[model samples]
Target: MVTLLEHCRIGPPSAAAEVSLPVTFFDMIWLYFHPIQRLLFYEFSCSNSHFLETIVPNLKASLSLTLKHFTPLAGNLVHPLIGSSKPVFQYKPGDSVSLTTAEANEAFDFNYLTGNQPRDSDDFYGFVPELPPEKIELDSKIIPLLALQVTLFPNAGICIGFTNHHSIGDASSIVGFIKAWSSVTKFVGDEQFLSGNSLPFYDRSVIKDPSGLATKFWNQMSIFKIESLPLNFPTNKVRATYILLESDIKKLKDLVIFKRPTLVHASSFTVTTAYVWTCLVKATAATTGDETDGEGTEYFAFAVDARRRLNPPAPPTYFGNCLGLVYTESTHEQLKGNDGFLIAAELIGELISKKVNNKEEILKDAENWISYFGELLNERISGVAGSPKFDLYDIDYGWGNPKKFESVSIDGDGSMSLCKSREFEGGLEIGLSLSKPKMDAFAPIFFGGLHADDSMPINPKENF
Candidate 1:
């Protein structure tokens, strides 16, 4: 069990002025999507008194100072009630972010929560705070952009949880905020030593939507009431962590090339996602038998950061969302067959190569994204949450590198999270949420395929 200790409001330092930022087309894609929730565990054994006196105060102060630079985070997304006006992030003088403090009972096992083994998905909900409910104010709807929680495990470590509305920012923007907050904490709330180059660029005008995609996307949001979207996660799911060492990725790449010699883009991201997608397909077929009809389409979707791809490339630190979707689909039979891995890898690699090379094509289909995603909402689709490029393990708040980082939002959808390995260089960590039966069937298929000889075929039925 977990008990709430305090609920405090934190804002930027005194003298910080109000600011407003226009929402871009990229941001509208996630306007009605579920919020992104994450947990970062740090192992620092300390008494409750010491944690309250030192850690709590330090984190609160550092976050306040950090918000002075990232003002939008402490603000709210104001969606205009009038049909003509677009949504914008508005920060008033008294605007602040919610910070909750909680303590977990002794029964909670810190090690088990941070380990690679499967654990109850509900165990993580306590650490993550929820975004404030949307409110109607004046002529606009006010939605909180970010909320945070710090949970103490008594003599064990502490867990820092973050829940942010997807419309406010993407992973890159959030990571930048954490880096700034951590830097401030490490230096004891000192901002002088912080690097200016690392600061976020909040100029939304840099994102050019030549096709008027923003207005088009805003019109699509009317199709469904935002309140109707699913926010409650499934309780029967179990969360697990899986690792792919450097050698495993190399072997997977080699296998793809051997099967499809013309394959041009077999990077770590492509191969890892392809392999996981194929494994999930087979696992679902083996355990649930829901999409085994061979004719059903299995879709794989993920977002690509378009910061550098934009014309007159936006700064690397450009805040808010600058992403494009890469959606690919295949028949169930094609994905669960003997050559499924190779097929997935080739399709992903080809699509990625095309998008990476042709910048003009990135937003060509932006208008159809909502409808496309809506169609696949309840279908046999799988998506990815985090990216290996984030290097999340490197985030240190003076306590040390994170013991474990998880994207808890994956439980809502059948998506997975990927990040660079914490202990191994060039390795990758994949976080998965599935029912017990599916997870049991997935382990062998995932590990057995990695260990199998090059000439041998991986039979999911045999493994099960």
Candidate 2:
């Protein structure tokens, strides 16, 4: 059980003028999707009184100061229900982000909850706060963009969780806000160091939709059920974290190169994702006996940051979503074959190479994005959330680096989360949510494949 301590309304340091940021085509892709949720656990032993006295005040103050720069986070997404005006992120003087403080009972184990082993997915719901209830005003539905929760495990530690509307921003934009918040907290709310270093560029015009993709995407949103709050994830699922050490990643990359001598773009991201994708496919097949016929099509989708890929590249500090989707597909048989990893790697590498090298055609499939993604929702698809480039572990509010970081949104869709490993340099962390049986089947295949000699062919069934 968790006890609600207090609900604080955190806003900017002082009243600021109203601001509105236009939702671009990039943002429309996720306009009605479930909000992204994440949890960062830090180990700090202190009494409840000390926590409320020192930690709570510092976090609240630092967050308020951080909000002065990221005003949209404390704002709302205004979507006209009866008209053609695209959604806009609007911030008014009195707007603030909801910050909920809660205390978990002693029954909850901080260490077990932060471990890499499979844990009940429901265990995390307590740490995630709900977005402010949506409001309808003058034909426009107002949706809160972000909500936060700071949960204390008594004498154990603290877990900070946040849920944000995906339309408000992508990983890059949100991670920037986190880094800034941590910086201010570490310096006791001194934002002087963030002036030019991490200040976000809120100019929405940097994202150009010359092809009128914004209108096309908005039209597509009409078919989606836009929820005021994030949809609840189903139960009977367990979340687990896996790591690909530097050496493990190198082994996978070497195998890909050895199999496909001419292949290009076998970066750590591509190879690691491919290996995990293959394992997931086989693990699912092993448990359900579905797709074992080998003729079914399997899909893998991920997003690429378009900040630098744009025609007139936007600054890395540019706020909002600037992403391009990269979707790939192959036969289940091909992915389950002896050379499955190589095949998956080649397909991903080829597409990534094409996407990155030819920015002019990045949105060639923009018009079909909604339909394409919608179709895969109920299909044999595996998408990815987060990215290793975010370096999430480096985020610290003077409590030392996070003992564990989790992208909880992946539970909504069987998507995986990728980030830099907290303990291993040059390695990657992969988080997955699967049923207990599938997780049971996945563990051996994932770890066994890595331990298998690289010179030998990888057989998922044999690994199991």
Candidate 3:
């Protein structure tokens, strides 16, 4: 029998046992490929400025738990079944180091699900798995896998990498888990290990029992992408900015109320997505030779979460394909003709609330969207040329809160933007991706809205 305080005591144990469970081929595949599907990823490198320090290592005794200790904990969400479910661990770990580099050497292989071959062959589950420690420039790179380096620069000058893979968890869960991991670090004192006994409720699958309610929302899903390659990136790096401020949000709220006279309330995501789409439309249009007018090239993607909408709403933890897409279409000419920004914003909000609040559509959407992804990547349609996926607004890390936020881990092929709320302030943070050529054209449009307030700097490009 397990006791409360007895189990509450934390730290490494003398010994451990084994655990394992079976996972569906489908879930495993999903976890690896679209690891950061609905999440925001950023790519940032350390600066060459001053500031130096060294990490004092506890170069003492140690015990390293490998696949064995994790043996018994398999077959569910916890066990990312990429490798065999066998459990193993060692009495000691090998070369420990400080300051690990966190950059991926390759672009993401996006065509996993639809293609063929053995189920496990397309595996991509686990994260970069190496969490290296870092110190100021004074010290040399030493840490093992956790080779991470961060330095704060004055005037919004710091690059950060934020990676949230879909398999390990969602954006919400990603931050939550990171906090948990941080608390267990040696620097934090008596480390706390979330015991392997914490069993997960693995029955949260939407496709288990599909009904008419899940069938109706099929047509609502559309793939979101932006035209690309018109410009190339310098040094092969993908970078972006995402922010959302209180004042701007209020303005958006007021605009939504004025335009959608029928709706009692408009969700923030809906309104924001509309504005983002509008910006993308305008930016693409401006790049066009007036004659083309941003035709066939302006489209945006929004998510339709399928939790509270089904006949019987999903469980509180139903975290699988609970998301589908809502696509919007317009040329720069059409979007700019009227108060398209406001109109589009209001429409986006309603589209979100309507589809998310409805269940019948989500299930059908999941099935069809997966199928559509198959067609697009299959090269049947020219869809994958360069898709710009905009992730949700993310801003919940619990320390005193971050001084700055950035998306650092995107396969950053074309352009993907993530919107973030500014820390301890009133303004917004927007993370946007652009082709090298397009960056010059896009920067002015983004700063124009945020810097509208005179007290704010005239140009944030240097800071951004």
Q: Give stretches of model 2 more than 4 Å off.
A: 224-234, 290-293, 454-464
lDDT of 1 by residue, 320-412 (tens): 999888788899999988889899998899899887557888777778887777777767888899899899987889989999998999888
lDDT of each: 0.87, 0.86, 0.36
lDDT tens readout by residue for model 3, 1-464: 11111101111233443222222222322332322322222222223232122111210111122111221211123321234332111112122212212222223322221121112211221112223222322222211111222222222222222233343333333343333333333333323434523222334443344343222222221232221222222334334454455555666676678767776446555555566556655565566644553344355454444445655665544423344445544555666545766666655555555655556544444545444443333221111111122112232211223333333333333324344443425444444444444455556665575455454334353325
Cα RMSD of all models vs. native, in order, equals 2.9, 2.8, 13.4
Candidate 2 residue lDDT tens string, 399-449: 899999988888887799999998878878899999999999999889777
Error of 2 at 74 (Å): 0.6
TM-score, per-candidate, Cα-based: 0.95, 0.95, 0.56
Name model 3 segments beyond 4 Å from true: 1-165, 186-207, 211-242, 263-265, 291-297, 304-322, 374-400, 411-416, 424-427, 449-464
Given candidate 2, what's the lDDT at residue 3?
Answer: 94
Model 1 regions lying over 4 Å from their true place? 190-193, 224-228, 231-234, 454-464
